[model samples]
Target: RAYRMTETRGIIHRRVQSIIFVLIATACFLAVSVLLVFAPLLGRLAEAHLEWIKPYMGTITIWRYIIASTVIVIGLFSVHIWLPAGKRRFVSIIPGIVFTLVAWLVGS
Candidate 1:
């Protein structure tokens, strides 16, 4: 049966790991969504309290892009490492992660 296959592959024994991964993924998704929802409000607050940064909005936007890209890379790397049935070395997965990010960037 399908259960036997999963058991043999050690997936059944990793219920806790799977749950943790799902929880973390959900948290990350919710965090991003909440950030998006409040971004305008936050921007207004920032502009009101920090007038000196108004002229540098372009530079701040570039930094935001860099930070967002870094978060995406880390999220992709975590998916590559944690979603599989067995252990994976970080170095072994870097190339695939990089390729995936590049493909995503190009596609977008």
Candidate 2:
């Protein structure tokens, strides 16, 4: 029963996740990746205001959390809705890539 549910979800989710996953993943990655990409720029700012910004530094560092949360919530909800019973789930890169490309094109 569990296995069946997961397969049903895969069938349904593959399509939807393909449509929106990439855009959201890109958005999420961009949010976190930018900071790492521009670490030198942040270093400059940090030097100028270490004492004040120190407290919120951790929070400010992870804008990508929003993207991650959004994706997880949407993906889980989608699975719950679309999946049948008796199915379990697994993860693989091909599905991820397909989903990303679809999401990139369809989401825009």
Candidate 3:
């Protein structure tokens, strides 16, 4: 009984750690995406418009992009993390690469 309890505790601990790790990683990716999206938009706005537009656009456009990107990353990685261990690597990496390529193509 004691051994079983200890094993369960270890499993619980591992799960908690993994969840925290995922959250941090998701946050980081979201931040990076937000910065990436924000800089170009701000630049365009600056070039075509005035400085006054900065504050107005920052909240509406920048925040929305940050939230949306975060959600997308979370959605994709959730599927990756939830799948069985054997299939997870394939599931996570393949879709990621495909999506990245499509994004680059469309952007270019």
Candidate 4:
């Protein structure tokens, strides 16, 4: 009976771990999804900040947007790796690229 109880506990632990991992991955996916959907707005915000500092900066810091987009893309890729295969994995890249493009266009 004790052995059986131990085995059951171990199994439950594994299942709980899996559920937690999946939940975290889903949250990441949702976050990136929202970020992609609002990328244009984010771009506008970045642009506005740039405009505010243009005088002191003396030129547009295009590199800032490039770097930011790069970081966002890296995060998207990280989450993509955690997502299960099929449609979820395939669709993950689209928004990341769009976000990058929007950042570049709006920043410039």
Tens-place lDDT per residue, model 2, 25-88, is 5665665455555654785589587877777666765654455445554554445443334423
lDDT of 3 at 41: 73
- Give the winner by lDDT: 1
Worst ten-residue run, lDDT, model 4? 1-10
Backbone clashes for every candidate come to 0, 17, 0, 0
Model 2 has an lDDT value of 0.55
Candidate 4 TM-score, C-alpha based: 0.34
**Which order, best to worst by TM-score?**
1, 3, 2, 4
lDDT of 4 by residue, 5-42 (tens): 22333566767766876676676556655545565566
CA lDDT, candidate 1, residue 46: 85
TM-score of 2: 0.35
Task: Estimate candidate 1's RMSD in Å.
Answer: 4.8
Which runs in model 1 stand beyond 4 Å of their true positions?
1-13, 32-50
Each model's Cα RMSD = 4.8, 9.6, 10.3, 11.8
lDDT of 4 at 89: 42
Tell me the lDDT of model 2 at 23: 68
